[model samples]
Target: MLDIFRGLKSLIKISHIHIDSAVFRLHYSLTVILLIAFSLIVTTRQYVGNPIDCIHSKDLPEDVLNTYCWIHSTYTITAAYRKREGLEVPFPGVDNSKSYSETERKEYKYYQWVCFMLFLQAILFYTPRWLWKGWEGGKIHALMMDLDIGLCSEVEKKQKKKMLLDYLWENLRFHNWWAYRYYLCEVLALLNVIGQMFLMNRFFDGAFLTFGIDVLRFLESDQEDRVDPMIYVFPRMTKCTFYKYGVSGEVERHDAVCILPLNVVNEKIYVFLWFWFLFLGVLSFFTVLYRILIIFSPRTRVYLLRMRFRLVRRDAVETIVRRSKVGDWFLLYMLGENLDTVIYRDVMHELANKLASRHHHGVKGELQEA
Candidate 1:
């Protein structure tokens, strides 16, 4: 188990440079790592101890009854949740009486599938990053022109700066598709979070969507009136029925009280995930909204550039914004993120001057022609 977790530690390390927002990295990197770690921890028998254990009658084989209950799943009586734990019910869902109707019993089968489901969810969270990386195809890296390494020779730095400026001048407005793809990936991340939440709700028999909310409400409610949402959703104890043949060839029904130790880990994992997904959903939502602002408002682009690279002059930023399209600004903004602020300021100043010169020359030619 220590070796496995040590391997997982490598995944959480910052092994590569990131070209996306923190929120984006949260989805593809941190969230994926967390999900996989939880899955592995739960799947490991040493950590989880036993998946399920049941108390059986002296007549029944304990191992056989435990295995049967684990394979077939266990159930909780709904009305038992309202009863006090120490008084009417030994636990949240344990009942020895056979008087409860089948309609009142809720079967729990999610435990067996928890690890598999978590792995699947990790893949889903990473899908957007994969798509974005494929579509981006090293565009930012190629355009960076080794400027990311600021220790280059002065001659090389000058030459690289000229090349970068020339590329920007020649390719203005051409990066709309590239920028759009990244934005689309951001939107996809938000959708993926929402979709996963919905899937988890269904997977947990509709208990997950509001799991966090119920937990919060439970925390604030009077203890006497409250039913623990965690226990309700992930009961630590439940009832299972196993059947076998008697010595006389008659069928015997054995009711067993099963303890689900895995749910202890499960409840914590999901409660944290519920809050995390909600946070990511909101962050992604605002990120998309900010993207829309960047698209529709030129002043927003100028303001963002100025804010991000304070050394860049306001007029220089405005000049670039005035002369370029949203795609060009987006590319430049991304480039600014990769380049040092001082170097970026120099690049922006030179680009602004070059654009001004071009505009002047074009106007002079038109005047001469007229």
Candidate 2:
């Protein structure tokens, strides 16, 4: 309890976020927080109150009622039924007319498994981000942060561009070689999404087997204003057999139904998560492509910066930056780095104007010589 309070106090002491957090990290944090909230509070509430409520005989003895509830809670009966099948003793075989259906066996723990899977999903998403942060956080991030600060502090445009060019040449090349390591993290993130699509399908129902086409089918069915049992996030009820207990150790039996309220919550949670994973999966897919283009091909680099920053002189940019000098700068910029593109745009414009002036002057000199 004291430790909990200490942790809360430390959180209160936080003034601001120093490091620029990425999109994936933010998503991972939200996922973990929601998982904790639902597991600890939402699903847990269903287990509160009575575990078993016996019915049938209004005048059933209180002792027998309590005993039945306790016994039924012991075994996990899913969905099996028997009908007054056992022999009853004439002595203390006073089998109460009341009985409860208890078909689910040991499967009572399934609701908790939902929480475990969601928690696992959140952790898996974070794994790649942590890997990238571990590699980039200490080295590339710090260096880019310093460049961002220095570039901003400079007053002269020439000095600012010079600083950027120096850093672009000196540090960016070394880091760009290892940039694929970061993309490996993106690959992991992409796999995490793809994996969840199938994982949820296997765990809950077959709807996820189509990898999102099933989700569309579910929506179309919803337009008809009908419930589709096939698309439910979790299995709600299961079948099991009730053990008829009385004097002489046994008496009667009946059909039973095991209700899981967690299934209701699971339906809502997984539906949202399924779509969420799809969105992230698509985004990660393209991010990998762009990362590849920026690293290996200079022409591709120029094209992306022209589109991304909306620069005017693509031809000049293509001439100025061959491999990844500008590509490296733009690459870090796109990955939630603190660098400002306004400075880069201004520098590119100035360079393009200079190149244009030199070309015009050379053309005029050639005409005079002729």
Candidate 3:
């Protein structure tokens, strides 16, 4: 048990080198850990405590009645949510109506599967990271070439810088595929969040997509106009019909009021997730747009590099941006993030000078030939 918790703890540990963006990390690490934690909490409470208790007649065995109702399922009256509590009904979704048909009863099966669903969602959230890791295969880390460490000997530093620059020059204009793979991962993250919202709506019988919006409106609406979305979605009090043999060996219907303590925990968990997913969706949408800008606009790349390192001059940044394709620029951007600021600045300066001199020599030879 201790080992299990320790493993979960490791999921949130910060990595020394980051190959992905902040939003990407949030999707794979913090969001995954939170979902798993919620799943465990719900599973533990459902099994360790009395998840359901029903008020039944003295003649019926309490344990058997409770077990039967829990396993077969409990339901809420669809019309009761519209009725005022304490006046027309004892509790929201707990009506004593003889005219209610089976169709009027909305049986909740999601409560039983909540833990498993949550765990599955955690896996979905990590899928993009898994795909990206396989495709990335430590490319950035390999190119970093220990430039992250600034205390190396001067000779070693120069040699490493030359080797890195030579590779970048050789591989110029060939990195579009690599960079596009990462952008595809970002797009997948956005799609996953949107897809999960719809999945939860289906899981909750189509009440999840607008859950956060409904809650916000409920808070701002007048008291008389307010309807608790949480109660409507996860009713605490419900009804169950149990059948048994009576004194004359005839069948009898026993209506019992069941209190679901698990729903109380479930309501809070989903409310938090509703708002959290909305936030992630908005963030991821903009992240994709930002990536598009980076791909299409070379000037944006120049500005970003200059902003990231103030010491890197505008002309040098522009020269590098003009000479390199999107893939080379992306690789240099990532290296800037991982490498020491001073080392990155020096490398960029030297690479810019070499590329500029090569361009000058090519133009001079062309003029002489003419």
Candidate 4:
């Protein structure tokens, strides 16, 4: 444990963490912001708005009120009834609360579960990034930070840039095996996006599971005064019944309406979230393919490097990448498809130049000293 802390301290001292890509932005930053904002909107609206409106016998007992609140927080069956001989009997009527078919309660009390589930989904999306960071051991961030800092150095004679690149490709010097951290992150990101499509369905409506195939596309917005128990993007208007039996063989009933103010926020947020995930999923798939292709194809890597560096010949890039010991992982790390080309072209150019210089100057014998 002590050794681990010392290593962590050294890692932090070496370089700061970098977010690295758009996939990261979606999983960590955007997911968190969306979850928190939606959750808060739901919660705050309930506190300030009339979320539950119960229509029942006035001046009811305290126990009945408690029961009404409890059932109102959950899903309750709604139906119609007609009064006969002082007894309320089930009968269909447009204004009567007693004639609707049985419906299951929502899986929430006051829509708390919706936000809770969304928050859980956010956590799920974040887990891959958390795992990647754990495996990174701070090396990726350190390399980028060191390179960025050194690239801006006023000391032209300093070898800090070269030393940093050497550190990045060190295993290449000894083991001939490249560290595959970046590819692993990309693969994990792709999986996270795919898994979320399934995982979120369990928490959300069937439309999400079916990619909106199972959703009802009706505009019943004008019927706010009526009980509409159909599912939509905003499920605000629902009704339930509360029953209480007195010890003296007397029974009373309360039919109440349940509303979630957060439904408004959820309606807009989920629509956006669904499309955003789809877009991100497709992008991640291509990224996975790109990583796999570059890792296996030397010519492809050389071609990309030629485009990236603009000066290195194909043979030169290939020999330097293979002989000077740049692994698929580190090379891709610098040439990541997601990296901003303009901001990072200088760093990659420097690396290409170093490899070319090393080969041109016949410096293989001095490799140990480097």
Candidate 5:
């Protein structure tokens, strides 16, 4: 048991001792820097804006205010706006005009939640790679090499083992990294799409219209009681219309009360879509760029090329040895002829001389023996 334990310890030590100084350290530093920067960016910006204000209240209708309230209660928005007129507003609901069912809303909400979960998952998935790279005895180089080769093989196994390693090494490296980052960005893009869709549908359906109607009603009701300052001007404006020869003329006065225009809702939806498209496009573009970089970069390209050459060389050598015993003399000759010209010439010359001497037999053999 002690001998077994001692052997295991020695193996572990040997396995760990072959670390790549340059690549490992560079990757470690980069991982640490990116993690710190990402964390700092998320953390320091957290409290800079009012959390309640982020979601546009104008995008929410009065009918489904309860749903909005529920969402807000769970996840805070950074900003909100209050309409000046006081009215009993029901919880904002889905616009009846659009006829969206409860099931659809639930599904949309669920999709949003899934997106959020994916974003969280992406962060979690990235954390381990960062942590592993940062750790002291992490064997990052071996991990990278394994990623490059697509499989782990014992170094000592030549022929068949080397062939397997070479095959894996060429095709796997870029694909693994691409799959990870692509999924992450894709999930984030989907989340943005869902959130934006919800906001646009909510705002345009009845939120702005309801707000507009409420304002118009308030103005009309106040005018009936002569409590409205604008009410007094109607008579004068009417008289001015009579005096202006069949045209209604009025004072060039504007209302001081700020009306939140419905156009703002349209603009909000436009901006949301624009940003959503832009972000997704950028993410996709970067993914493609990284893939190209992996393909074209000197180190990666050279590594892939070398792996391919090794595969070819191993296969050629194996084929020669396999057929040499079988009477495939023609195939063996072809292979030998195709080998590196200088090596082929030297090998052929040596073999030819040996065969000639063997046929000559006793004359050369007796001279050498004497």
Candidate 6:
């Protein structure tokens, strides 16, 4: 028991020693500052305007005022719906059917503010790592190019081809499996999107009325019509419009004739884009799946057996050649093994000698020899 306790103590001490002081301090400071800044921003944004004041104002409805209050509170925290109009609007509710208390609004606003700050911080933190990975990938690509050039000797061609075949075989195992699954998923998503289109149409029809005559006409009509409908209709519509001549009794409706067609076209375009993107994504996914399956499948086992048989046949031929000329075979084997190491040097020397020979022999003799 004492030994176990001692071991735990040692492990803890080792872990503590491994922790970098600079990194730990920097992380702690950044976390503290982020927290402090977020809190301050949230607090300021939340209670900037009083919900009670907006509610009491005759210019807006109780529901509208309450909605503004609620939205202000909610967005102060979440901030997902943050927009220029949202900031200016006294009420935050979409259609003003709901009202928010001052306390609720404040809390919501704070929540949104915190959410926004966290989202921004997350992006900032991840961007550096993403950039570093891109740089490393570029360097790796350059290294691969150098390696390919160095390895491109005639003697090393057979070995290089064998290595490439091995790599392809391994990758194919994963690809095959991935392709099958990806095809299945793509078919399902296509069916789902088709089903959703019908449902989306119904949803738009239901919601369209609210935005059309109700909201637009209210904006296009006179001041009396613009006044809170609940206040005017429930209490005194006759008194409100009594003095105005030819007020048409019918509210001046702003024809959103363009809206329905525009919305339909937009929806069609969005669905088209969605299908296109989903198809591309599935194509890529399937390609990878097919490669994976080829690498791991039983079918690949048979393919590898064939490869082994071919390799053995080639080895037998090489063995016969080696037996016929043992010394030459040993030299050839050594040269093949270190082909990349000597290829550039040999090429340069050979080219220089040829050029010198050509200079001495003259262009006519050099051409005849070639």
Best by lDDT: 3
Summarize candidate 6's per-residue lDDT along 1-370 as a digit string, tens digits: 3443343333222221111122222222333343334434344444554322221334334545444444432222112113223454322222121243333221212222333543344343333334333433432232122333464665565454444334323332233332333334334433433433343334333322222234346567785335332211111101000111235675432100000112222323333433433443355355445445543453443343234333323333332232222222222222233334344233223333444454567867878989
Better of 1 and 2 by TM-score: 1
Please rank every candidate by lDDT, starting with the best. Answer: 3, 1, 4, 2, 6, 5
Positional deviation of residue 264's Cα in model 6 after best superposition, in angstroms:
5.9
Error of 4 at 96 (Å): 6.1
What's the CA error at residue 280 for candidate 1, in Å?
Answer: 0.8
Q: What does the lDDT read for residue 361 in candidate 5?
A: 85
Q: Compare candidates 2 and 4 on lDDT and give the better one.
A: 4
- With candidate 6 superimposed using the best TM-score fit, by how many Å does residue 22's alpha carbon deviate from the native? 43
Task: Write the residue-wise lDDT of candidate 4 on 104-128 in tens digits.
Answer: 2333453556667776776776777
lDDT of 5 by residue, 201-285 (tens): 3633423223333434656675423222111111101100001112245533211111112223223333333443345445545
List, residue by residue over 1-370, the lDDT tens digit for candidate 3: 3455677876777867888999999999989999998898888888887889999999999999988988898888888887888898899888875878878888877888999999999999999999999998998898787889888999999898888888887888899898899999999999999999999999999999999899899899998768899988988988999999999999999999999999999999999999999999999999999999998999999989888889888999999999988888888888898998888899889989989999999999999999
Worst 10 residues of 3 by lDDT: 1-10
Prediction RMSDs, each to the true structure: 1.5, 9.1, 1.8, 9.1, 21.6, 21.9
Report the Cα lDDT for candidate 4. 0.54
Q: Candidate 4, which segments miss by more than 4 Å at Cα?
A: 1-19, 61-110, 144-157, 165-170, 173-181, 211-233, 246-249, 311-315, 324-370
Cα lDDT tens digits, model 2, 93-171, are 1122234242323333344466577667767766876786676655444434444444454555456566555554455
Better of 2 and 3 by TM-score: 3
Which runs of model 6 end up more than 4 angstroms from their true locations?
1-136, 146-265, 294-370
Candidate 4: pairs in clash: 75-105, 79-97, 79-98, 79-99, 79-100, 80-98, 80-99, 81-98
Deviation in Å, model 5, residue 349 alpha carbon: 26
Number of colliding residue pairs in model 1: 0
